[model samples]
Target: MKKNKNLLEVPNINSSDAQLKKIIYKVEDNIFNRFFNSFSKSEYLCVCSGGTTSSCARDNFITLDLRKEYDHIHLEKEKNLIKIGGGVIMKDLMNFLGSQNKIFPTGLSKLPGAGYLLTGGISPLSRRYGLAIDNIETIKGYLGNGTFISLEKNNLSSDQKLLWEGFKGAAPFLAIITEIGLKTFQAHPIQIIEGFINDNELSKIINLAEGFPENLSLQWIYAQDIYIYILAEIRNDLDKEITKKYLNKLENFSSLKIKTYENYNQINFFPKELDLFELNKNNHSEVISLLGEDLKERIQIFIKCMKEIIRSKPNNSCYVASQQLGGKTKEIDPKSSFFIHRKSTWKPWIYASWKKDDLKEKEIVLNWMNESWEKLKIFFPKIHLAQIHNHLNSHEEEVYLSFEERLSELKTLKNICDPESILPPL
Candidate 1:
């Protein structure tokens, strides 16, 4: 394949040294089929929806950029469902769904693309409604062997049924999704309570949140300071009183702020200091996400280890943050998707970063991230394959941990669907 020197660079959210040999834009049926048939088997292949995952492109790989061509969003009111193209991001999806008085499970930040849904999207709202994958009703994509496939929940052959199960949580390894159909819920009134607290209060909050109803979820971050955020969906006056009572039980909170929003898109989950725009731009970062049960008795020891990790931070951006995930998320059957760790109550991610092109700082920060993961692994035994790290040494281990007993089955499907290994390796 000849390189397209004039083609604009793939704008990935996570800045990395990985380079693309050529970028194919406007991937219509003709272009996609032609490219898929023409590329040599030795050439690596990947897709860029919102340009977030590291595995989207490797050194000299041919990348398909979906941002321009596959961004259509349509709502099917009769079924209360929405169909979004591969290129759509969380912000656009939320804003569009909000206008229609509908909601979907999206992450705390709004920039991730289809990969978020493909990797089993976890949101504060996920505690009530299920994971993003659980909402998928239809998927249209090309399998690794250059065959166009469209599968719906209601109609599927045995092979397609197996492919459907794999697409839910292990899509990137199976095919290139061009569009997805998702079930949307009626938008509801929501409230947010945010405050900064010390280590002691953090433990207290975690314990208190463990017993919270499905409508309430907790997300906490330990950066320069510890910040706790609570998301409550108000179905009635009772929920409001219950949220207030929980707040009253807390001992101390700095800069406590409470606000209610009429819909999902109207809410801002992060503080001004940790702006999403700033975090995405002008920085190179890596993240490793973990799934674990409630800390409970291990809260104190976990906190101690966390404090040490925070104190030894390589930079201001390196920190640990966790989100609550148990309630409705656990209701789904384990066999339904590749997300086997449904028993998890918390999803904590270790993040490390350095200035772009700062190789020395990159080495130091990556070391810190791995070391921090080593200390916290005992508490968080399962890994979450949220962000792809195929280029890193932990890729195989993370993939295995993400899908333990199911790995062998997924591999068998990989051989049948992706004999040439066109998609990311299993």
Candidate 2:
């Protein structure tokens, strides 16, 4: 086995390189085939993306780092499709699309890779275009059993169709996706209003946001303070007037800052403070994302719970945030994807962080995250498996919540695709 120490550097600190023994940097056809067939069945194998969000690696695990090998971007203008390697990051993809005057549904942070799409990507414009998975036209990858498969949305046999559905929301647990083809959209003007809000304004904002148009969406983060962002796609004069009326309602907030961009990629919703916190080399963090219904009646109680949780946070890095997801997202066919929470209006995620290798701090932060999730479960019951946590005690619980009814079908498909359990446990 080829052991390249430099290949071990992933974004998340939870899976330290010190714990890994084998990392294959070569992903070419013949080399990868040889490595895959020869690797021991007992060994834990994970395909690491360029923008890894968590430490999916563990002690003695083997990783296929696609960062260098799979970094190509091929755009088919005639077909309005963008094909990218698994290692391609959101920022790079957006830049390329912007240069061509095209757009895609990318999340606020531009660091994530294909894992974002495989997890059912949620973008500010998702209210209009639907989840990222809904736009994926093609997928090519290798199942855990060393089988290569190329699947397309319009062209698939019955078995290939079933596998395609499995890959949509449960890909990390089934295959190593090497290339993905996503349907692109025409670039349009984007309007953004971002600012801080008091505890009282949060409820009002959410209430008003319920009636937001398909092109408009709300996102807010609660750490030491509450920050809110309203994004709208300005397609015409009507859109501008609608967005203006919504902004006028929030004029009571003195800190609101409004800006217009040519495309969604130009807008960055994350606060600078949080960005700086993420830049801290000593920080190690984990996030659990949960889905919920509209908090119309439980707004106050939800705020109170968040306040209590924040008060007990281990550090400044731990916080709870949510994004709206009820417009076009809910209009998709229920049987199409693994994201089954069609009635979900919000996706709230708890972020916990501490200094790297501080075992005491890690334990405390993890406890805080777990407790926060439990408390929020009263309002937000479903889980969004954005990142698989094989190391956590709640891994099974998260899996149960994420796949729900389709889980049995998924299990059957898993048996056929990954009978040896080479991928993360389902």
Q: What clash count goes with each model?
A: 0, 0
Q: How far out, in Å, is residue 287 in model 1?
A: 0.9
Q: Model 1, 1-426: lDDT tens per residue? A: 225452334445343356557777654556545665776766657778877666666667777778788999999999988999988988899999988988998989787899999999999899999899999999998877767888898898886777898998999888888899999998889888887788988887888998898999999989888887899998778887987787787635656678789977787776566542235355688889999998889998999999999999887778899999999999889899988999999999988888767889989999999899899999998998998787788889999999999999999988977877777786
lDDT of 2 at 300: 88
CA lDDT, candidate 2, residue 136: 97
Number of clashes in model 2? 0
Q: lDDT tens string, model 2, 1-426?
A: 226564366666665434566766555556445555666766557777754566456667777777688889999999999999988889899999989988999887787888888899988889999989999999998887778889999999977887888888999878889899999999889988888788888888888888899989999988888888899998889988988898888788778888889987677668565452344557888889999888987888988898899899988778888898988999998689888887888999998999887889999999999999999999999999998887789899999999999999999988988887878878
CA lDDT of each candidate?
0.83, 0.84
Q: List the residue pairs that clash in candidate 2.
A: none
TM-score of each: 0.93, 0.94
TM-score of 1: 0.93
Best by TM-score: 2
lDDT comparing candidate 1 with the true structure: 0.83
